[model samples]
Target chain A: MCTVCGCGEGDTKLEGQSIHQLPPHAFIRGAGGHHHHAHTHSHAPGMTQARMVQIEQDILGKNNQYAARNRQWFADRAILALNLVSSPGSGKTTLLTETLTRLQGNVPMAVVEGDQQTSNDADRIRATGVPALQINTGKGCHLDAHMVGHALESLPIDNGGILFIENVGNLVCPAAFDLGEAHKVVILSVTEGEDKPIKYPDMFHAANLMILNKIDLLPYLRFDVAKCEEYARRVNPNIQILHVSATSGEGMEGWLNWLQQQRP
Target chain B: MHEMSLCEGVLQVLEDEAKRQNFTKVKSVWLEIGTMSGVEIEAMRFCFDAVVGNSLADGAKLEIIEIPAEAWCLNCAQSVAVKQRFDACPVCGSYQLQVIRGDEMRIKELEVE
Candidate 1:
């Protein structure tokens, strides 16, 4: 039997049950379909009486382990790490560029940009005179803790500084992997459907805050600001929200002030 | 969409167990997937089968036990069944809730030889 959880029926129990389910930093997606069953088929011929090896392990255990180590590294340096996530065309890069430009000399900052291809986003961040590391995931859709840990070497962030990790332009896959950030800020543009929170509940619930971007266009668009906030709150009650437009610089003060307060 | 990566994670765990527990081949794998975990069973199985080809877990049966999410309603101070992350409290219809269970993907048990 396994010593920790007493899980196996075999004489030799595999040790280490690193299975843990945290409240959510938003990661790896595997949802839908209500099929639930205990499946057991016939074993391979001549190999009878399969021993039930009790090995209770979390699927995300390895990623979480790497995340924990990265978290410790950040903690030791007193760095405020933030993960920014959103769907494609959410103006995340624009907002990031505008924010970095405004807070350039006020705070020491660095960025790690994640994408499936190209170093375009990192190059955009570099335009603002900030150190940016581009992690081209190639075939991968999400940036896990292990990749972020390796990216740390490339992006030399100073102590007491802030590091923003811009995840791939995906709302689903990125929600399941923790990148060892102090907070996960999800940016949702007003142009998107108000029911986005309901459609992507896991991401909304995992995020510490939701940035309602492109508010300047709200006047031209029919987006209901109240309804959008209401929908977000329905999914995650404790999530803090802010409205801003990187283009027009509307509500940029609140965004900047929020970052300052989080500085270690 | 990330079901492939999640499936790969499962494979890694299986390979580790094979090395540590002296199992040469795996016959079956049991996974406990939470409803609120956002993992689709069909996609997970597809990815599992595709990746297991030529590996130690080739032809292994994938068993999934769907776990229902549970949360504590702050308004009514009751534990309610949550099928999804956005599910409101069944009692008071309040959104304020503290999730107590689910949001997990654990390898519960395995059949090996």
Candidate 2:
């Protein structure tokens, strides 16, 4: 299911791949090039000179530009975009469903679901009576800003609304791609290892907040809440941690309050 | 792997540079990959070959310059070398390390004709 390179996940039918590939016509390309110093040497007669061109550029430079545009779009519309990242089965969709159900009539909300192959998550969000769009990464591992920029075209959103971008379930790749969200919220379930923050430090480091989901099962499991929080803080000193069970709605008020506070 | 997408990004830069800098062929590429950049060097190398095939950098040599991860330890008030994201400050054993450098993946230079 690795859409980043399309290897190893095995289920690569890519049903939504072709649909998402439509050119983002509204995207404006900025003039791009760095101040490069090219050193040339003509070694032989009638031979092409071998030159070293100094092209100092970030590899994710293009993606960053798109993310910047997306950021601008969100800012202009006063949209509270939250990029939710986590490993598979971390109950991200469950949390979103619960959050949407609670805030249905109060606030305007939209969702962008990222998965490798299916529109199932988007279906769940739409079932909640919220506008939802699905972005299947195909063999891709993460959702880049370009895909999101395109998704924004079809999504019906109101000003100052919450747009939750549920990133493809991966701790490794999604951390690297920015989708123009205000904050990255990494979800870690108690069913998973408590040391996941350390094991996947890149993700924990990138996230501004960490939601320790499925906390209602704490009574049945040996998961240590304090230890997990400590480990998360080790990688990300300023990361705010929240404990919640999307299924049982435990500690959801704090989660909702936090969401409300993030709104512009 | 994301390394594959990273390789695609490298190829894209090369293509863009080719059009701007008036280079039809790329001979070699020098990449600066930081240790804390979360990129596997071997994976990058493996994907690079597959990505640049039949492109402007079809036969280009790939050279990666590994950058060591360094962070500013607030506890010790000095820069410290770090190997991982969870590494504590060597002197004070504190986790309050603000990364100052070494989380980059950049195209540093290119040998073109």
**Quick one: best DockQ, which candidate?**
2
Clashes of 2: 6
Over 4 Å off, model 1:
A1-49
Candidate 2's C-alpha runs over 4 A off are A1-17, A20-47
Which lDDT tens digits does candidate 1 get at residues A1-264? 123222211111011111122221122223433333444676677865578999899998878887998999899999999999999999999999999999889788999888877778888999999998887765678888876776775577889889999998988888889989989999999889878888988888889989999998887888888888888898889999999999999989999999988877
RMSD of 1: 9.4
Q: Provide the overall lDDT of each model, using Cα atoms, as 2-decimal numbers.
A: 0.81, 0.86
**CAPRI verdict (incorrect, acceptable, medium, high) for model 1:** acceptable
TM-score of each: 0.86, 0.90
lDDT per residue (tens digit) for residues B1-113 in model 1 = 68877877787788778899988778789999988888998999988877666566777899999988899999999899988777789999988988888887999999887
TM-score of chain B of each: 0.95, 0.98
